[model samples]
Target: MTDRVLYLVVCGAPLAKRVGDGVRAARESGWSPYLIPTDAALPWLETQDLEGAPVLTANRKPGAPKRAPVADAVAVVPTTFNTLNAWANGNAGTYPLTTLCAALGARTPTVAVPFAKHDLAGHPAWLASLAVLRYAGVRVVNPHDGSSTALAPVASGTGEEVAKRFQWSWVLNQLQEAGA
Candidate 1:
């Protein structure tokens, strides 16, 4: 296994369909990536190869051994409106949320690529949540590029088109620069 461990957390969004590409890219970059998909993301993952990376959907049973190695970094690709708001509000209602909250609490080097549409991004809570996460040391990158600048919301009915051109390198570069 690689010395670098990455928790590749995925949410249900059009971008999720390309998650296998992310996993392969992580491996190619020498990171041992583990998949942590929200329940909504399951359908998209059905066809992903995962490159043998372990998929952790739920917490281990009490007293059970750990599911994967400690994460050296985290990449929350396709961070949906629901997941973003919930995580920023510190809601650990789901396993993915619990993982995100714990990572924040531990100050793990984290990156989030929001994939919400313009309509959802118009909500006050959307920007507020991104601000909260940024204040807490998470690197919020634009889904279109790796820029740390303010993200532009995806246009309606164009999520799949956006996903098609999304590059895994954007997220990987952020983690590398973070020294993860």
Candidate 2:
């Protein structure tokens, strides 16, 4: 198998499909992508057709061999309002949150893409969380300003054309620099 990158999906129902599309694109580009869903998201993911991608459970321990740092970059696609708020406040209570904390601790470059209803996305709490995440060294990408959805291709260009268009390229460069 090709070396894989860890892709974490928080809890956006709409964003999951977009994320899956991005995963398909990334895999087509020759990267093995793995999905880890939050506890609140498992049931939904099970009901959807994810094209056979593996799902990591919330309760799984941190030391499993499969959990090793295999990717130079970790992307948190469609981060929900709750999860984003929790992460900004340093709450590592769930699998996705804990994994994110670990990745940050290890100094892995991360790209967090937040998705919420337009009103919620503009709320003060969400904005504050975005600021906090930036302060914590996480690259925060949003679907605004004509960027594509952070992970998936744009369906109608409603949101940003894509958040952090440079992300995958940056990650690949980082991996090359590390001689991975």
Candidate 3:
């Protein structure tokens, strides 16, 4: 895993606030994690600071980034419901989505840590999207239930319980298991 480049892409979700710790945890686990935040997730970095990781996003142009490392595997942490659905339906409309879609095309191993409200969780479309992503080889990690949907909030509160319950460990562990 040390030689592999692990990409940690963030979507807008409550758990995203504490992802810097997850970044450090990933480093401790021997993975080189690059942080990629979705356009909606961009504001997260303004209030949160993540050290020692190179952050990347698409330039909206049709070429590979000059400085971006090719992803050996990807973990879309705290993936929002909309992002999850769009990604499943082949919507590479955002920078994060475009990058992830490319990685999927190249057969790079990918994982997703989803976070959604209870109401959203019950939607048929959301469930189907989870299935689509899983069928496409993305290991959808369901922190709430062992079942598919693959979403779980750390705690009922905001992002405070992340250290105790966010399942950052699970994400990194799966990345390792993916040979990331």
> Which one wins on TM-score?
1
Candidate 2 per-residue lDDT over residues 1-180, each given as its tens digit:
557565555465445555556566657656666687876666656555566667777555577566544555567766778888987877899878877777767777777666666666667898798777777777665444323224232344443434334244433333334343
Query: Which residue runs of candidate 2 sit more than 4 Å off their true CA positions?
Result: 47-49, 61-70, 144-180
> What is the C-alpha lDDT profile of model 1 across 37-76, one tens digit per residue?
9999999999878778789999789999998878899999
Q: Against the unseen true structure, what C-alpha lDDT does each candidate score?
A: 0.91, 0.61, 0.76
Q: Which ten residues in a row have the lowest lDDT in candidate 1?
A: 141-150
- Cα deviation at 95, candidate 1, in Å, is 0.9
The candidate with the higher TM-score, 1 or 3, is 1
Q: Rank the candidates by TM-score, best first.
A: 1, 3, 2
lDDT of 3 by residue, 6-80 (tens): 888998776677778877887788778888898777787666658768788666456744666687889898788
As for lDDT, the candidate ahead, 1 or 2, is 1
Give the least accurate 10-residue stretch of model 3, judged by summed lDDT.
145-154
Error of 3 at 24 (Å): 0.7
Model 3 residue runs over 4 Å out of place are 60-65, 144-164
RMSD of 2: 5.6
Candidate 1 Cα deviation (angstroms), residue 52: 1.4
Q: Against the true structure, candidate 1 has what lDDT? A: 0.91
